[model samples]
Target: MLIRLAIRDVVLIEALDLDFSAGLGALTGETGAGKSILLDSLGLALGARADSGLVRHGADRAVVTASFDVSEDSVVTGLLADNGLEGEPGEPLIVRRIVKADGGSRASINDQPVSAALLRELGTRLVEIHGQHDDRGLLNARGHRALLDAFGRFDTGPIATTHARWRAAEAALEAARADIETAERDREWLDHAVAELRQLAPEAGEEETLAADRAAMQKGARLAEDLGHVTTHLDGSDGALAGLRQAARRLDRIAHEHEALATALAALDRAVIEASEAEDALAEAGRAMAFEPERLDAIETRLFDLRGIARKHRVQPDQLAALAEELEARLSRIEAGGAGLAALERAVAAARTDYEREAAALSDARAGAALRLDKAVAGELAPLKLDAARFRTAIERLPEAQWGADGRDRVEFLISTNPGAPFAPLVKIASGGELSRFILALKVALAEAAGARTMIFDEIDRGVGGAVASAIGDRLARLSTKAQLLVVTHSPQVAARADRQLLIAKSHDGTVTRTGVRLLDEGERREEIARMLSGAEVTDEARAQAGKLLAA
Candidate 1:
């Protein structure tokens, strides 16, 4: 509920701070007493359109601030989080709007800077303002469905889930159709590529192995002479191993003659053994480097085929296998299009059936709820001097294109002000005075269901008096039981019903004027009501009537 409002340099308002409480509060004043200015100030804080002319004549700017207290689990908390704004759940939501003399505006919430658009978005969660020309409340057609659904206590979640599944089915069918279309466009290329890849049967690691083998085979032919030269030093005709072997034989024969001779003979034998081993290694290497043109040709052919195919596909040699697999899969899907399409179509049909069932149920629930709502609102009219007015909840089926998860129904509150009158929309059919009373009837009907913590009506008792005015007051008081209600009224009967009353008045200091509000005490309230009852003069009879009204 709105907790406080402050205004500065706004038209006739100089500096004002009004603290509000939860209940049926009334603001009463004579004409030109700045009551409208007070509401305008509140509207500015709620992100209404700014006007430079609203600023005081000698002031640089005008400012209005409104604060509200809401529950921790309210949608407001989620909205704040979604917008990246920090909020403490226990603290009041303070929204401030400042209008510059040059026709500019700035907005803030909880002293943190915000855009005016954002402030307005938050305002809808906290306060609902209804006037003759207001459209944001029940008058808006977009909100009618939700409002009706909320009132009916109907859960639309199932419909939403079913709709989501239907949409998913649609997406799948589209994709399958798109795949078929694309495959039709690329049929020839796909067939050729798949056939070539199947024939080649490329392996993931085959490219590197082939390249290495090709390099070894090609380089081995070029290094044949150099390899032979190295072999000659160890195992060829000019190798030193023959001389060492001849020396070892001679030394072994003399080894028995002397100990020193035996040592020398042992060394010669060991050297001969080492020379033979080294010669064997050189001979093995000579075989490894042996030239073979036919083998080299085979390796070159394999490497060239792999590299050429990879380049043709504009892929790395290693990725060729993966590319081949992907193409094979797409081709397989295209071939299976008939069965796949049939399955998708069946799934779409099933999902649509599911959605239709749930949507039908929701539509039935709305029809039932609309009947009850029409009855309830009609019951409220006669007491408010609208006995002949016919209230209706129009539940019409929307076109196929506008069908939604909430069902295919378009719900709107319509009215007929006279007998035999064709029903028209609520906003279009009512006069200024009639609209206010109609708004009052709606408030009485939807206050608890609206989910708005604060409901403000401007002069809802306009052009009403006696028992009709009293009836308006009675309904306003009942609405306050559901939520915080504030009404600006001229009727003494309405003023007498307030849980708290504020008298808006103007005062002058020197040449300057200011608007202010004061909470009326019991005595002051009686006098104020008397003034309302008797016009400018509070006669004894008016005071007695005011006393009786207050007592009642």
Candidate 2:
């Protein structure tokens, strides 16, 4: 319920603060006395569009703050938690908005900054404004389905889930069919490529190993002649080893004759031994470095074959193996295309069946709920003096192409104002007053369903008077028992029914004009109602009638 509204520098309202209780409250004043300005201010706080013209003359900005008391389980509380705003069970929820003269605006919930869109989303759950010109709430056919579901207390989560699953299945089936068709078109190429790869299978890293081996063998071929020359020099009859042996024998013959000769003979013997060891080491290296021409030819041939195949497939040597596996898998899928496509089709059929079952059940339930709703709304119309009118909840089964998560049915509220008249849409057939009354009747019918805590009716009693106005007032008061109701009315009958009455009056201070609201005391309320009854003048007769209306 809306507990308080504070406004500053908005249009004709310079500054105003009003506290509201939970019941029927009436704002009564003459036309053009700024009753609409108050509603606009409240709308601004509830995230309505901002306009620079709303700023009062000579003021740079306009601010509006609305506070409400929401229960812990109310939709408003859930929205607060969703937005990270503070709305403890025992505390009030505050929504504040400021509109600048430059046509810019900002909003906050509980002092935490928020976007205008978020504020608007939360506002819908907090208050619903209904009037003859309203396009939201009950009048909008687009929201009719949701209103019906809420009235029926139906949970639509299951059908929504089923519809999503059905769509996914359809998508999967389409993709599989496309894949099979493309693979069939390329069947010949896949077959040839897989065969070639199988015949000359290329191993990973084989190219680099073969190239390195070929390099080593070619280098060995180049060094073979030089190695032979060094071997001949080390082991030839006139080489360094043979000369060392001849010198050692001569030195040994003379060693017994002189000490100097013996020392020379020993050094020559050591030189001969060193030369022999050098020859052995050279021989071992020659054996290790030897290369055969046949082996070199085979390595070159293998490398060439690998490179040619890689170029043919538009891939490197190492990637040929992976590419081969992928092609083989595609070929296998093609061979089994008939079975795979059949499986996908069956899956899609199953999903469609499930969706249809759930959708049919929901449609049946909606039909039943629609009948009950029509009955409930019928009970409300006569009291508001529309006994000749008929209300209908029209549920049409839409075509399959238009099926959706909501169901296969389109629901709209239709009415016929006179007997034998065909039922037509609410907007097309009803006048402004009739539309307002229709909306009221619908609201009363759906009152038991969950909805916004506060409902504001803008002149719902516009064209009616006397008993009709009294009936409207009585209904408004009755509706207030379910939710807070604030009505802007000119009917004295309605004014007499209000638990609280506020008078909107405009005043001018020579050069400046302003509008203010004053809560009426019992005597003051009686006078205001009397003024309403007598038009600009308050006669003794009007006062006596006003007293009777209040006393009754």
Candidate 3:
């Protein structure tokens, strides 16, 4: 429930701090008594859009702050936690909004800065403002389904779970269809590529190995002619090694005839040995240089084919093997397309059946809920002076193809204000006075189910009089049994119903005008109620009526 409201420099309200209480409280004053200004300030603190003109004439900015005391598990607390604001269980949440004269605004919750949009989102969960022109409470189409469920005390868990199942099935079906379409589109290319790769029989690292062998063979071929010429010269019949051996044999035959000749024969034998070693080395070189052109040609051909295949596939040679394997798998799936598609279709059909069954159940539940809600709201209308008004929970079927997260039903609150009057939307058919009463009836019906600790009614008595005003006040007081209510009103009867009474008055000083609110005592409340009933005069009869009202 809203615990406090503080306002500064907002239009006629220069500075004001008002503490609120649980149960039905009323704010009453004459016209132009700054009652509207007070509510407007509360609205600002609740994240309503700010206007530069709202700032006081001499002030640079305007500020509004509201404090709410909510339970630990309240939706407002969850919202604050979601936005990283601070709040403890059963603690008061302070939401402050500041609007500068330059058309800029700031918002915060529990002293932590937050965006105005976030603050507004949190505010909606905490407080609902119902007025003549206010389409928020039960009149909003967005909340009609929720209101219906609440009124009927229907459990929505099953419906939500069913909706989730339906969406999941839909998502899976879509994904499968996309996959099938893409595979079908690429079927021809995949088949051809797979066949080509199978024919090529590419292997990882084959290109590098083959290229290295081809290069070695080509180098050998380039040096083959030079090696052959050197071999011929080294092994010819009159080559140095053969000639040296012949000379060594002749020197050995004459070595005993002369010592010097024997020494020369020894040196010639060493030279022949060195020449023979040289000849052996040349023969080994000749064998190594004998290049096999056929082997070289084979290596070149393999290398060219590998490189060509890599280029055709737009991949490096090393990636060709992996790419081919992937293509083969894709082609295999395409070849078995009939079987694959049939299996997917069966899965999709089964999922759809499950989803449809759940959705149908949810639809039935909602229909039942709507019936009960219609009766409940109708029962609440007579006392609120809406005897001729009709309340409806209208549900229409959405196309199965257009089903969404909320399922296939569009729910709206439809109403007919008079007999034989065609039922139109509640917001369109109900007059300002009628809308306020309708909202009150619905709130009284669903207050317990909504679990809202507080319900604030801003001038809900607008355009009402006499018994109708008393009826409104009586219902408000009754509503306080379940939850707190704060009403800003001009009706003396409405003021008379409060467990507490507050008066908002504007007073001007020599330099500035200020707005302030005071909680009235029993005597003061009587005078205030008299002021509301008799306008400028406080008559004895009005006070007598006020006394009777208080006694009642």
Write model 3 residue lDDT over 58-148, tens digit each, in one string. 8999999989887643576667767788677657889999999988999999988888888787877877778877867667787777666
- TM-score for all models, in order of appearance: 0.93, 0.79, 0.79
Candidate 1 local Cα displacement, residue 337, angstroms: 0.5
Q: Which should have the higher lDDT, number 2 or number 3?
A: 2
User: What TM-score quantifies how close candidate 1 is to the native fold?
Assistant: 0.93
Q: Candidate 2, residue 291: CA error in Å?
A: 4.3
Worst 10 residues of 3 by lDDT: 282-291
Candidate scoring better on TM-score of 1 and 2: 1
Cα lDDT tens digits, model 2, 1-552, are: 899999999999999999999899999988899999999999988889999999999999999999988864457777788778865558888999999998799999998999999998888888899988888878778888988999999999999998998889889989988998999899899999899988878788898989998888888788889888887777788887888888888778779998888888888888889889989888876665668899999999999988999998889988888888999999999999899889988988998999999999998999999999999999999988889999999999899999988889899999999999999889889889988888888988898777788999999888889988998888888889999999999999988998999999999999989999999999999999999999998999999999999997
Local distance difference test scores for all models: 0.87, 0.90, 0.80
By summed lDDT, which 10 consecutive residues of candidate 2 come out lowest?
A: 71-80
Better of 1 and 3 by lDDT: 1
